[model samples]
Target: MLLDELVVTADAVASTRSRLAKVDALAELLRRLEPDEIAPAIGFLVGKPRQGRVGVGWRSVGAAMGQPADAATVTVAELDAMLDRLAATSGAGSAGGRSHELRELTARATEREQGFIARVLLGEMRTGALEGVLTDAIARAADRPGPVVRRAATLSGDLGETARLALTATEAELEAVGLVVGRPVLPMLAATASSAAAALETTGEASVEYKLDGARIQAHRVGDDVRIFTRNLADVTHRLPEVVEVVRGLPVHDVILDGETLSLDEDGVPRPFQETMSRFGADAARATLLHPWFFDVLHVDGRDLLDEPLATRLAELERIAAAYRIPGEVTTDPEVAERVSREALAAGQEGVVVKAIGSTYAAGRRGSSWIKVKPVHTYDLVVLACEWGSGRRTGWLSNLHLGALDPTGEFGEPGGYVMVGKTFKGLTDALLKWQTEYFPQIEQRRTENTVWVEPTTVVEIAIDGVQASTRYPGGIALRFARVKRYRDDKRPEEADTIQTLRGLLRM
Candidate 1:
């Protein structure tokens, strides 16, 4: 199919806010794709290239711009092959070579096609439909059940391949996709709850396990061979030799274990999350050892437990790898769940995960079956500036640079503020318009993409919490920060301090 066809479909998908409309548009596109075009079409629609991050950045694409062609001529297969060649370009002078190839490719595309290719390369499709929407769209196109498509896609961990199968293969073939011993399946996820008691009330008899603030790992072992994958399914077997060694020590001959891994100090106490990440991101030469804490077993021996209930899976986990299991209890009593949560928090862990006992593993999706209870912190913060938006948010100020009032002139002027992080969440179209209009009235300066304003607009911000960081001048950063609303009743002088935000590090 013509690349322009996919571009127009992506535009149609982005132009709607209705989920049904997006799914319908995507399903229509999927139905039109030829069998050979299915995988590349899926990737382009999701704003990714078949080759994956082909060393092309904004600067490379921006520099490659040229006059557009008058007609749609490039095929999706042609573009995918071009990207494969670009991804393979390397060695000295490869940058120039890649740029030449990109310019040649961009020269062949129309202006609209050029924009679409840029968006795909920059990872800014901004379409309402992501993998979740596409999953539903695949089901619609295939006339299969949504849960079946979701399960197959999640277990396979590749929506491109899932789309291919949904378009070409029979339902029985799709259902045959199951957990492999040495191939990583997407790890199951959890939804957040306000409190442990509330979560237990939702799940009734639940398994309240300690939720560690560490990197997620999915270990797949077959006999003496082991492979470890991150939540995104990227293999990191070399960086996690210690984790592989631990899994090798387990009694199981073949297994798939989902768990968390973190660096610990000499006392066996978990280190700060940032410290754990620093070690986790390093190569195998790092001295700090990462310890694994197993929580769920998806496959053990010759048995596949993904379709099994959580209670049965936990029993299998206990029988095979009890010593590696995270500390927790199983009960219907809320008070007992609360005690376990408190003990976990007191022991310097993040929080507790309350899981439904009878729910089957819903891999790669956050559902009600598992709920995580973590403390939330709210603060009145200042908006220092705002960046121009894109796609649906075009012509509006979207990303807000957030700051905390720094009373002591240690980082800046005596009363000046220090930036903690930036956020574009929780903004409706009306809010975006208001910010675009109001922020310029207090403008301090301007850049091509951002408008700097006086740090006087106080807004209430909610965050999972704060953590130690070297990125900001305040030595801390907010985790999952989102604006609740503008605090018109409060002034900048009354905004929360950096010191106050830093106190959350202790918790």
Candidate 2:
């Protein structure tokens, strides 16, 4: 298929607020793609290239811009091949080689295609075709059941492959996609609650586990060989050898465990989140050790526990990894839930996650079966822009323009962010220095005082609450917003939504 065709579809998807219309437009596009073109096309549509980061930044993209082709001639396969070459370019002179390749690739594209390529390279595609909507589109195009496609995608952890199977293979073949021991599945997500009692009301007879402020990890072990993956499914087995050893020591021969890992100080208190993340990003393991705390077991000795109730999974987790299980209690009483929350906070943990005992694991979905309650209101929001600091903090990027996700475009552009508020508070000198150096690297555009960046940085912000306001496009502004920390583990799409902030008005 021509690249322009896909660009046109993406434009169509972005120009509307109705999810059905977006899905229909994407489904129409999907129906026209060849089997081999499906994955790359999907990647471009969602702003996540299959090649991942191709070492191309905004400046690189800008440097490569030239006169566009008069007509569209670039094919999807050709674009995919170009991305492959760009990803492979690395060495002493790789920068020049990448620049040459990008220029050549862009030179072959029409004006609209050039813009599409730029957005895709910058990871700033603002189209409304989120994964869920595109998944529905895949189902629509393939004439398959939505649940079947969704299950296959969730289990396989590859939406592109799921689309391929749903469109080209038989339904039975698609249904055969099961949870593999080695492949990491998407982690289960949770909703937010104000307090333990509120969370308990949503999840009756729950397992209230400590919500640790740590990086999420999923470990898969087959005998002595164990693999560790981050919540984003990036394998970090080599970086987290201690975690591998812990999983290897488990009683079971084969298992899949979901948990968190954090470095602890001498007092057994968890270290700052950044300290723990530093270990994950290092070339060699740091001196600080990260202790793995398993909360749920998904697979054990060949039995798939994902379909099993939390009670069953907890039983399996206790039997196999009791020593590493996170502290929690099984109770229906609101008072007991509150006590657990208090205990967790006193232990320097985040709060408590109340999980329904009878609920099965719903991978990649934030259902009411699990609710996280924190004493303070905090949200993961995106950094939309940064402004220059003044006075004593001059020459640094101090004030952050924060935005919340608007996946459905209820308040703004679909699949874009809605600016909620700005903050220069809670940032240490080190953070300010880092921002000054980093924001320029991803800078999309700039004014005299503000640097508008791609909405890709996820920062945890603590807020008193939100109130109705016309100062922002979302009809609400954050009250007393301050940065808690930078969540390097999360993606822009994972940030909390505008609708979520608006919901706080009701409180």
When superposed on Cα atoms, how far off is each prediction in RMSD? Answer: 1.9, 12.2
- Which lDDT tens digits does candidate 1 get at residues 1-507? 899988888888887788999899999989988898998888888776667788989899999988899988888888888888889999998899989988888888999999988888888887776889999999999898898899888988888888888889999999988777887777888998988999998998999999998999999999999999998787889999899999999998999999999988888888888888888888757989999999999998899998899999999999988888999999899899999999988888889999999999888889899999987778999999999987677788999999998899777888889999999988888899899999999999999999999999999999988778889999998899988999999999999988888888877
Q: What would you estimate as the lDDT of candidate 2?
A: 0.91
Candidate 2's error at 416, in angstroms? Answer: 31
lDDT of 1 at 246: 93
Weakest 10 consecutive residues, lDDT, candidate 2? 389-398
lDDT against the true structure, each candidate: 0.89, 0.91
Show the colliding residue pairs in model 1.
Answer: none
Clashing pairs in 2: none
Q: Point out where model 1 deviates above 4 Å.
A: 67-71
